[model samples]
Target: MSEFIEWGALGQVVVAGLIIGAGIPALFALGLRLLAGTTTQPQRAASGTRRAADGGVPAGPVAIARPTPARLVGAIACMGVVVGAIAFGLVFLVSGGH
Candidate 1:
């Protein structure tokens, strides 16, 4: 078995495969989580208000907070890694695995 397989090269291929396959999706998810800010819920109207006529529930638009500078940077970095990996794979394929 050892004679049939170059263990070192196979190990490297497995390691690279695992990293690219798992790391890219994980980074993308992290970027999305970082970029997704908190949503502001609609406030309830005071008593006897026009909105109160509709069971005190005011129909208002939910506002999404903008990501902080640090979060934005983090998201960019994470997504950049994912994109870079994809581009590298594409280039590798186009280059005929050269």
Candidate 2:
């Protein structure tokens, strides 16, 4: 009886893993489609600034610069801290910790 129950549990886990593995690509494709549908095409930057007939300076900066490495790292660190806090809360709840 115990052996039969273990086999059933193992079969359930195998079936669930197979389903999840099969679903991952479908889910990824669906997410891509949704993202593509919702996103607006970005406007192209002007190749060269148009100058006044009198030779005036260009109005704005040429290109937007990328964030510095420190800023990017700080932002990622903040996100990790938030996710870690949420995970700790979930673990505490599941473990019945006060």
Candidate 3:
């Protein structure tokens, strides 16, 4: 009698699904995080202007961030992987990988 379960194919499918489903999102999130970099202290106005609203809350300082070249490259790489995965998916679908 033939085996009912194709363990090898099932495993491959599960692994591929896990990698494509989880890894892609993780890479995208990593790219965003790397691009965003770390935030420094809030920036103060150059003119040294501070305004108080009618609600009595003073205006807060603006935020500033700068990403290093390495970080930028890493971010680009991660995003590239994500885009490539998407392209591969499109091609796979078009080629009837379904």
Candidate 4:
């Protein structure tokens, strides 16, 4: 049985499993805590102009900033490349490759 089992592969698998299984939940919980305030009720307008009964804003159009899909994709691709490069370097170092 020992002859059939590759310890390096087994260690990699275990490390990968721990990183994904444990890291994901921790990151998710952290993100949830960071965004917890967004779900709260909106604060009442201070001394600003009162809204009409129709609830229409008298101000000009509100500017809304949104992340574009292309930018998001680019960011993700960049991160993937960075992670891949780091992993490759780590693997090379672990395997004693100069």
Candidate 5:
């Protein structure tokens, strides 16, 4: 029975499964986090804007600051990798996994 099982192939399958299953979602989440950056008070709020009420209420709408150039680039790269991986999988399936 041991002779019939290909350990090398099994190992490869396990590694691939872990990467495609866990790695892709991790990268995607990272990309989303980088893209969102953070929310903060707007620069130079207009005088008309009322201040937040006492009790932790926000004075005005908080704005999400744009991601820095480096972070933006990193996010794009991560998303690109995810998309590429998905496309590759679809193509592979269509090609009969040859």
Candidate 6:
């Protein structure tokens, strides 16, 4: 046996740390991205009037963005994973996994 290090254990720790530390943030960001996708299309003015010769900004009601069902599902799924990971960590800490 090596005096200062066990390569197998060290490797496991490194891999686990990478996954838990980096992966959680990545997942959370993914969730936010999924949830925040714009689903609104540019809308024309409700009135039939067209823009003037200057061609300035059209006078119209603001377009409102709503989340698509798929995006909502994806975001919920990603957030669920993040929340589950947090819950698992808390449980692990309470159970002396440290």
Q: For this target, which candidate reaches the highest lDDT against the unseen true structure?
A: 1
* Model 5 lDDT, residue 95, Cα: 94
Using lDDT as the measure, name the better of candidate 3 and candidate 4: 3
Which candidate would rank higher by lDDT, 2 or 4? Answer: 4
- In terms of TM-score, the best-performing candidate is 5
User: 2-85, model 5: which lDDT tens digit per residue?
Assistant: 899999999999999899999999999999998886887655545645555644443555687789999999999999999999
Of 1 and 4, the candidate ranking higher by TM-score: 1
Candidate 1 regions off by >4 Å? 1-6, 47-59
- Per-residue lDDT, model 4, residue 60, is 37
Error of 2 at 25 (Å): 33
lDDT of each prediction vs. the true structure? 0.87, 0.56, 0.83, 0.59, 0.85, 0.84
Ranking by lDDT: 1, 5, 6, 3, 4, 2
Tell me how many residue pairs clash in candidate 1: 0
Cα lDDT tens digits, model 3, 20-61, are: 889999999999999995766555556635565524433565
Better structure of 2 and 5 per lDDT: 5
**Model 3 lDDT-worst window of ten:** 53-62
Tell me the lDDT of model 3 at 13.
96
User: What's the residue-level lDDT of 66 in candidate 3?
Assistant: 83
Where is the poorest 10-residue window by lDDT in model 6? Answer: 54-63
After best superposition, candidate 5 residue 82: deviation in angstroms? Answer: 0.6
Q: In candidate 6, how many Å is residue 74 off?
A: 0.7
Q: What are the runs in model 4 whose C-alpha is more than 4 Å off?
A: 1-64
